[model samples]
Target: MNVTLTLALFIAAWALLDYLKPQFVANLEDNILSFLLAIITLVSFGQVVARYGFNTGWSAALEFNMLAFSWLILFGMSYGIRTRLHLGVDILLQKVGPQTAKMLGIFGGLLGAFYALIILDGAVLSIVGVDKEGGAITYFAKMYKVGIGVEEMKYPAFVQEMFGLKRPHVQRWVVLLILPISLGLLAYRCLQASWHIYTGQCGSLIAGHEAESLVEENRGALKD
Candidate 1:
């Protein structure tokens, strides 16, 4: 199925990136997050101005924003892991010595990767599927086949005039298609971080120390 192929291709891409790590692959998540945030901010600002000033606004604005926000959260998780921006208590890590703490952090990273993959098992079977009917992953393919659309954002009359048939709205499958990819990417990031920790290429999985440094950098301004 399409879902299975996509996951497989993603796995291959991950390996390729490890060797090559071209800039585009490295920043793909960052680009996506920036785009989603930009559009969401613009649309929200426009909607408020239109509603209050003109008493009319895009009805689909709210629906669009919700989808964009969901997308932001999904992709942001992987980005956080990739950038080591995710926070952890690190109290136990501190108590341990440097060598022991490094091992513990690496262990936590591997566990994080496994957790992401396992969470997908309910919606997906092994990122592959139990069968057509057994996995929710297949539901995306079915939705695409049936050409189902979101409730809001119907196609305009111009689209019907040109195509000779009206589509209901933007397709749900297209919007939600990021779910599986985001989950897969989260697993990749966790494993990648774990490897870096083990190899001494990076420090803790948690950003606590980085966060402390950032706050210290701003403390003088805050005091002013």
Candidate 2:
């Protein structure tokens, strides 16, 4: 689990660096979420076909798919913030001048950052668990002391033997840590969006409505 967290942190750092580069186009969250969705779809469809057509299916398929689905939704929230895909009513913002709008957008981002911070704090508490001595347990302490595992999955026997692995089941706490991680990501994105808005690098905190833009485009076409 420590190794998993380290790897995740490394990937996140790389993603942040890539985001800072002007020419970088690939989105780490988008790529990961897309890959997860693809795997889930394939596994689900295969399971259905096997169960109905071949009268046999892997028992772990549903659990694995559900795990992947959970990760997708959890991570997608921050991705939505990064891409400005989340819906927001901007009627008042639209009426404001550019400078005022930018200020308001920054304030909105601060509010979002605060919200994410609260969620992150709660998630951290869950990940850490409570100590028997009525003290707060750190996530690092919990990771080392806890030996919880997922029930439906196991590593292949050959690979397990080769790696000299003791536990057959996947660790559940590692997956659960995504709660804090995703909330942290959401907070980071909120601050980043606010910074970009302040610097005039982006237009607003919320994305423009696609339907309204399409309608306006069609109206101009009709006039011309």
Model 2 C-alpha lDDT per residue in residues 160-182, reported as the tens digit of each score: 89999899887776566566667
* Candidate that scores best on lDDT: 1
Candidate 1 lDDT score at position 106: 90
Error of 1 at 163 (Å): 5.2
User: Candidate 2 has which clashing residue pairs, if any?
Assistant: none
Q: TM per model?
A: 0.82, 0.76
After superposition, candidate 2 runs with Cα above 4 Å error: 1-12, 19-25, 122-144, 208-211, 214-224
